[model samples]
Target chain A: MNYISASPALLPARAGVGFKPEHFGAIAADQQPLGFFEVHAENYMGAGGVPHAQLRFLRERYALSLHGVGLSIGSPEPLDRDHLARLRRLCALYQPESFSEHLAWSSHGGVYFNDLLPLPYTEETLAVVAAHVDETQTALGRRILIENPATYVRFSQSDIPETEFLTELTQRTGCGLLLDLNNVFVSARNHGESALGYLASFPLIAVGEIHLAGFFDASEAGAPLLIDSHGAQVADEVISLFEWTIEQAGPLPTLIEWDNDVPDWPLLLAEAMKAQDRLRHAERGYARRLDRRAL
Target chain B: MTSVMSGVAGDFAAALRDPLVTPPAMLSAHAAPAASTRFCVYRNNVAVSLIGALEARFPATRRLVGDEFFRAMARLYIKAQPPRSPLMMRYGDELPGFIARFEPAAEIVYLADIARLEAARTRAYHAADAEPLELSSLAALDPENFARLRLAPHPSLEIVESAFPIVTIWASCTGEAPLTAVEDWRCETALVARPRLEVEVRRAPPGAAAFLEALARGMSFGEAADSAAARAKDFDLALIIASLIGGGLLVPADGVKQMETIHGYLA
Candidate 1:
């Protein structure tokens, strides 16, 4: 399927937030419209309940994105058909505008670790990830946005840079990218690399959505290491990096994620509102650039 | 090719679960195995997140045992048996059984039952939605044929019977009741179901679980009532049925299935 043109129309180039059940009342009653709301697909995988009821209500109001956290897309083992089938069923039920999963695996040796475990970025690993993406896209009959992972370790066998690996996967599977700017900042800081340099090399045009979130500070062997905790407010550094990304990518569908210590609606909304301010600035800049080109 | 990839992935997986296992030789930071502490990030994430999933599902159990004790217990459980699938909402399905056999938890006789009750609530919350069987349908049934009617159990209904006062313990710890000593040591039965948006965990009298179980097995009302009466000498059929209706614990029939002759209906 031609994923880019598929409707309820692509997610608007505005700010969005990850859906938290606690914020359902506020989100449903709010007067201001959001660009979209992203939900972890696995949370609503059960047959029926309030999760679905709430999602259904939200679907009627705003664009929806089904984010898959358990596809285990980087596994060497065959793709889990049962999981793919569940995703298909969910898509049929909700008809979400977008679907995305991580560029990491969670299951191995017949066990799901429940963490987005990192993998080697080599040709062998690349083939495995590409095949998984192919199977998912074919199974769901829609292009998926594969998010760059927040990693603490890199493989010695990985000859490919993270950007090139992601770009190749998009090329092979016709998948789009979901650039998580906070993840970029986290991974870069952890690995002693420049976040700006990583984004400079990244294939920005293929990015369909963006994520910004908070990280906890930690260290390894007395060197600074950051954990993608997603349990707190977006860091000032991450927000700055996000602003830079919008300056280049020009107001994509950005999301504010606070999954763990999720604040009250007002606090979370303020985070999205902050991203919206930056996105609105980028939107106007793009408009002015268009007028200049016409002149 | 697949086996080699699996071997590589297996080593990575093993290291994440076991702090003892050496970090995989192929993994590093700045191109050296010196980043084993960095490797601990993935390890820590897996352990903390899985334990967090369990704690969320078993809040009452966590409360009965303080947060520290529960987490330490959960960590041991995770190490012994990590989740086999990614359907994490119900990941700790075997936790109750594990706690039952666990040596440390042996003295807390009711801890395992609390886990089971909490697990049942998780199931009830996610179970398929259904409407309550209307009272009018029961009222309209022919007197002779009513006893022969087979009611479908609501998908979310779960009956947990225990020798310990699990209902009181759960209610007290989960904010429905203030913490109080349970002076009366006795058996308890909890009817856990989400007939509507909210999951209701109600205490039931003796023989209620058996009655509901019999009904759930597709037995006729007469048979279920007989089973309940046999189990509990003082079983009141009216009271149990009233509780069932009040909780919307049975799926509403299709406008009440048309009944045949009395003998035919019983058959």
Candidate 2:
């Protein structure tokens, strides 16, 4: 079904906040200019009721992006066809502007973990993820954006770097990327790599959206361990990386994701405003670079 | 599947389920110790997230048992009954049964029933939408034919009957009724339905539970009333009918052909 229009112009290249049911009343009552709202597709997979009611109201006002965390797109096993069908039904109902899933897998052997479990990046895993993405896009009848995962451990047998794997997957499947800057920072810190170096190696041209979320920092065995907890404010360092990303990729559809310990509407909106400010700054810089090229 | 990837996924899944297991052997050794700690982070995330889903699904159960006890029990439940699907809203379907068999919670026998009621409420909240039968529509029916009328229950309707006073317990836990005020220790039934946006959980009237349950099973109104009257001594047909209509429990029978009884009356 032609749920959403074929044009890739639904969401504006500005900042939006993640939609939480707690903030539904406030969002409905307020007249804020938001770029779009993103929600976990699994949360609204219910048969019908308050979720659909709230989503219908929001979809009328703002563009929506369905960010799925449980597709198990990178699972070694084949993708769950039933789950994909439900996702397609949801997309048809909402006609969301963009639909995305993580690079991580959450299900295996008929048991779902409810957490985005990591996968080893290899030629074998790459083919698995590419096929899943291809199937998802075909099933939904729309292109999808696959987000990078925040990893805790790297596989010893893996030969490919995450950036290269993601690049190749996009190339093979024609999928876009949802560059979650907080994940980059968290994964890099946990693995003792430079976030900036990772960003530099990232294929910015294929980035269709960006995500900024908070991480919990802990020290384990005297080494920095960053958890992608999404429980706090976006770190200044992660925001800097976001700014760098915007400078390189121009103003993409940025989102402020606060999933756990979600604060009231105002605090979440303020975070989105922070992202909006960065986008504005990046927009000005892009215009200036264009003028410099003209000169 | 590549042996390396399959091996890593299997080991990772095992370690996430049981922390005592060593970190996946496939993890790079460059940050071996840190990777183990990081692996623990994933383990913690899996446990915490699943526990959170359960806590959200069964808030009353959690409140009945303190947070600490609930978390410990939930962790065990999560490990034993991991989700078969990725939908978190549907995660705790087995919790009610699990609680019934849980030894530590055996003292509170009514806990499982309360969890069942909560699950029913969740199901009702997410059930399909349908326009309820308007009371005005019933005015056209002949009074003599009312007994033979067949009415349908809304898709969101659920009646949870329990031997213990689950409605009282649920109400007390949700602050609808004071705990001290719940002195009646009799069996109770809860009527869960979402007539509008909010899911309403109310104590089912004396015979209304049986009446609604029968209607849900496609029984004729006369038969359902008979079932209710058989169950409750003070079954008032008029009062139960009013309650069902006013509560938005009844909908017009759809798809089922109206049948003619032996008396040549349309049912």
Candidate 3:
């Protein structure tokens, strides 16, 4: 049975925020002018109760995006068919406007680590990720987006760059990219790479959505190490990068993700407004470019 | 995948579990002065996230044990038993047993039972939804057939019996009573069920646990009453049945074709 009201065909190319339980009552009481709200798909896999109830209410009112964290799409082991089936069932129930998962692995050898563990970008890894994405898209009967992961260490034996790996996956499986700008910044800083340089090589045309979140900065032996903690507000550097990304890509569905230490509703809404402002700025810039071309 | 890549993944996992094990040597040392310090980031993430899951699942237990004790204990448990499933909601099922065997927590004898109750509540919150059988649904049944009536328990129904007053302790953690104020400590049975949207945890009356447990195992109503009566001399069958119906603990048994028809009609 259809669980949500008829929603738009795609999430509006505007600003959204990660859905947290604390804000459920507030969001329900007053509909914020949000583009959409995103939730971790695993949180709603439960058979019944508040999570589903709140999700149903939100799905009826606003556009919804089901972003998954536990798909383990980059694992060496065969895809977990049971987990995939559950995800398929959820997608059928909600029919979310967008479904996305990370380009990282969480489960290996049947043990699931809670963190999004990084993987080496290699030909073998690419083949595995592409096949998994293909399987996921086929099972769900919709194209999925794969987000880049924040990494701490790189593999010495890896041959392919992160952008190349994502591009190859998109080409092979026809999947889109969920460009997490914060993760790009975090991984670049953590690995001593230039964030802008990474963005220059990134296949922005394939980006279907954008994620901006906060990171924690710690020094390991005096070198800056950025962790994707998602505990605080989006950093200035990340926001600047987001603006540049929107300038390049001409506005996509952007999300402000504050999963840990979630703020009060007004604070969260303000963050979304920031993203919305950037999106509108991009729109205006794109309009001016078109006007120039016409001139 | 290449053996080298697989080996690196395996070693990385091992190092995360055990801090003493050095990070896999294949890690490219581009950013940090020491790869080990960088590797600690993943280790910290795994520990903190798993601990957070446990904390959410067993808030009362964590409160009773204090934050430092809980975190240290949770870290040990994480090392010994990581989650086998990607579902975070179902991550801490093994925690109660681990706490039971944990040496440091031996002083708090009732802690494990409290954890069990919390876990049961978590499970009930996520269990499948079902429309409960109303008390009036049984009106059409003949008095003679009442003895043979087989009742089904709700999908979320869970009975947790403990030697310590786990219900009072759990309730105390929620501010119903202070922990030190629990003077009369006695064995308690908790009936956790999600009759509707909100999961309710109530103290089951004397002998009610036995009655529900028997019925949950497919015993006839008369047989379950007898079992409960045998366990507690004060077992009042009528009162227990009313409580069960009120709490939405009992459903129409699938084995009874007539009951299914009746349930359909009620629906």
The prediction achieving the highest lDDT against the true structure is 3
True contacts kept of each: 0.64, 0.70, 0.66
| Model 2 root mean square deviation, Cα atoms | 4.8
Give the DockQ (2 decimals) of all models.
0.43, 0.45, 0.48
Tens-place lDDT per residue, model 3, A91-161, is 88888999999998888777899789888888888888888898898888888888999988888878999
Segments in model 1 whose C-alpha atoms lie over 4 Å from true places = A1-9, A220-222, B31-33, B253-267
Q: What is the interface RMSD of each candidate, in Å?
A: 7.8, 8.3, 5.4
lDDT by residue (A1-295, candidate 2, tens digit) is: 1122333334689999899999988898887778999989887877667987898898888889999988999888989988888888888878999999999989988999988888888888988888889999999998888899998778877889999999898788888888999999988887878999999999887788899999987865657777888889999999899988999877989999998899998899999998898899999999999999999
lDDT of 2 at A87: 89
Q: In DockQ, how does model 2 score against the reference complex?
A: 0.45
Worst 10 residues of 2 chain B by lDDT: B258-267
lDDT of 2 at A188: 88
Docking class of 2: acceptable
lDDT of 3 at A136: 90
**TM-score for every candidate vs. truth?**
0.93, 0.94, 0.92
List the per-model TM-score of the A chain. Answer: 0.95, 0.96, 0.95
Please write out the lDDT profile of model 2 over residues B197-258, one tens digit for every residue.
78988777789877877887888888889998999898998888777887887776662222
lDDT tens readout by residue for model 1, A183-249: 9999998888999999998988888899999999876455778899898888998888887887887
lDDT of 2 at B16: 81
